[model samples]
Target: MLDPDLAFGEPVDDFSHCGTGECRVNTLPVLYRLNQVISESSGLADALRIILDIMRVSLRMDRGIITLYDRRSDTIFIHESFGLTDEERKRGIYAPGEGITGKVVESGQAIVVPRLSESADFLNRTGSPESERRAKAAFICVPIMLGKKVLGTIAGERVYRSRLLLKQDAEFIAAIALMIAPLAELYLIANVEKVALETENLRLRNELKERYQPANIIGNSKPMQEVYELIRKVSTSRATVLILGESGVGKELVAGAIHYSSAASEGPFVKFNCAAIPENLAESGLFGHEKGAFTGALAAHKGSFEQADGGTIFLDEVGELTLAVQAKLLRVLQERVIERVGGSRPLKVDVRIIAATNRDLAAMVERGEFREDLYYRLYVVPITVPPLRDRGSDVILLTDHFVAQSSRANHKSIKRISTPALNMLMAYHWPGNVRELENVIERAVILSDDDVIHGYNLPPSLQTSDETGTTFGVSLESKIHAVEYEMIVEALKSSNGNVGLAANELGLTRRMLGLRMERYGISYKTFRTGTPPRR
Candidate 1:
């Protein structure tokens, strides 16, 4: 007897010796074919197509159908079928316990009919054929059971004259259904995970696209405006760009702006830090290697150049590359091709190069440390990112941008910076540049207790001394006034003692400037060549 959860517990007398006949030979080969087909298939639809085709040819089963329960719609719909017209497949849907297929799925058991036409529960939903050949066939419907739950049903029809017994055929189909149950469940789960990952990837790409826009660089200073113009000019061509700047002055940010705003923005943007790789493996890291290229090389690998094909490759600290690697890189820049570490064939690539370095490549070339040929090739388009000190008032703009970012990230309620804190930030000489400014602001945001970022929350280095090496160790209010006084004095001198011009340059009204000057006992004429008479 079959298991109680799988079928009715009754044995037919005539079919008791059916397995001894042709059943064992035919059923064993069909199971082997099912395994072979399922292993080669990558999708559930293809696997089911092969499984049903094997049943039709080897077991003489036709009109095969597989239906899975749709939990969302609360119905069983045909997922795969063989020997059915297109119109018939479209009409194959049943609610639980509504028809023979639905009944099997609902009952968690099997149903077998010796003559499909004689069974009152058989609903021939498939379109009519010329010979009415399906009406005279025997039918078998089996629930695909796992433990106690019925996941789906598999059913098929065979002509009555076949040598296979109905009971033997029913058991064979049920065993195959049991084998396919786990595989179908796994396929469904994998598909869901793949969709989720794709959605997340698209979101990240959009974020990168927006973050690298020229308007998003956060500066209105003349130096920054020049950098923006250079970015626009260089983005129109495919020439190699060499970015010169101190460390942490946003060289990578400039690289991203060039790539995403260029014609090749739709293509990939691959980044590699030349200083991060080991000297011995630098060649393999830049140019991919074939399988068994070295001790641990088990498979073919694509290096940065190949990965960045049809796009741009940003090599940070390109000055650190050894002479041997530099010689190979020169070949790539000259011919747009690369040879794998262990392979003889040279593969052509269409990558645009954007290399950045803090060191002077000209000096390196003079010393013969860096190849002169590569230096000229990369120097075709050069853009220098100005350090933090050169961009006078951009520090306050950057500080506010970072404060807002850190507020949202850390879930703080910081809204504005106190005047004293802003004064200190503007006075410091940021050797580490914009990157360091962002770090300081993020730290201040985290440490700040009130909604406003006060002087006490800032780092000690920024607060103690000004860029001119002058120390203001007084109270916070007094230090703020001192920094204000110094800035006013410098502005007045630059304006040649014109109070109106000084006020406009300092982002202040003339009346406010005069009031502050009188309070600080500063006469505009002392530093200027000649003073304009008071209006």
Candidate 2:
């Protein structure tokens, strides 16, 4: 019988036996057996046998049964049992809110009676006559807990009552139960995560089905969102948008969105990166190339601007276009018209222009590198996107998002990044910006052999042994020292062994550079020549 003090309501701890034999020696062996079974077993069936083996050898019970609570049916059923034939085991299963087991579950406490005949709740469906006789005999039933939840119970008849079932028996059972809780919890959590990951993957896949979907643009930063919002607003209108950002931040996606949402919603959305186009054929490509327009112009072909007539044309890296090409583009924007190369008769067509550039065209205009009038024309409704490093919190958010995404893409199941890997990601400055961050995340996800992405898998840029920030915090002297070292190095390299040249490179007079070098306690000769100065 279960000790009242060691009932299912409390964690059984105090172990003292009325008399010791099988119950005394069974605890360690039962635990070891459970470990062996769980290690060998793969699924629920194996898990049940693992538990059953514990009961058979440890408790010396005549028969043992485990019942799992069915939420939908509001009852318990036999997941599996031990010490009975397969048919008999199946027969021992009982409904919840029925029998002593059901009452124990409802009550949330272990109930053991010395005499089963006296118990009113004992609705015993005995396996056979022999089992029936055993059922009238003595037994112990304790709730199986996966943490605080009652998964079900372990119940059986004592084979031979040589010793009274004391606090020790319940303590040993609870020990096994306590150990099982964590495993069960892990199984439940892992299964839930797997399902959730799969569902998210399916949704993302469906989004990519359309020729144009917002999901194609991968960024969660506020700047990126602002770009998306602007695209969404003006997409329905005939108003043109000129995207402005560093190269590789996905400006074409914005243009695609504009086209998909505009009056020419069903029309084609063509893209042409201006910088990628050769200077010789730039105009012909913007307009159309007639047969023999150039030596390689084998046949008449429509350009991007013409192909996207009644639709939208995305002009990426527009700042790279030559002055001649810029003038033609200005004319195209001024009037919705395009002329095929060598063909006269102006081809008037309705087309929207969406332009993007990484260069500061205003500065270029000041330097006469780009046209001033064309700059004004293209600067209309400019949307500038911030670099990845500037967008705080978006880095890790996008990292997790990409990890989940790439995991599905590569048929992998990476769960998360290790702390060191995450620390590296957070600390490192992404100079290549969002595009670089995306590439790194994709690679990390692919290279992750374990569920956790470790620091070893991180790109070399993040692997700098500069753990200085963590230890030093913010020190003005350290910063100044680093800056001083950089300046000296620059001066030395630019000077090329000449002190005057080094001094001129530093924008300091030779006399001043010599004085400064002396003050810092260094000979100019030692620095220029790869030799240490005498102290």
Candidate topping lDDT: 1
Model 2, 86-107: lDDT tens digits are: 4344345445557888866666
Where model 1 places Cα greater than 4 Å from the true spot, the runs are 1-198, 466-470, 473-535
Q: For residues 290-337, write the lDDT of model 1, one tens digit per residue.
A: 999998999999999999999999999999999999999999999999
Task: Name the lDDT value of residue 171 in candidate 1.
Answer: 82
Worst 10 residues of 1 by lDDT: 1-10
> Worst lDDT window (10 residues) for model 2?
465-474
Query: Residue 41, candidate 1: how far off, in angstroms?
Result: 22
The C-alpha stretches of model 2 lying farther than 4 A from their native spots are: 1-221, 465-535
lDDT of 2: 0.66
Per-candidate clashes, comma-separated: 0, 0
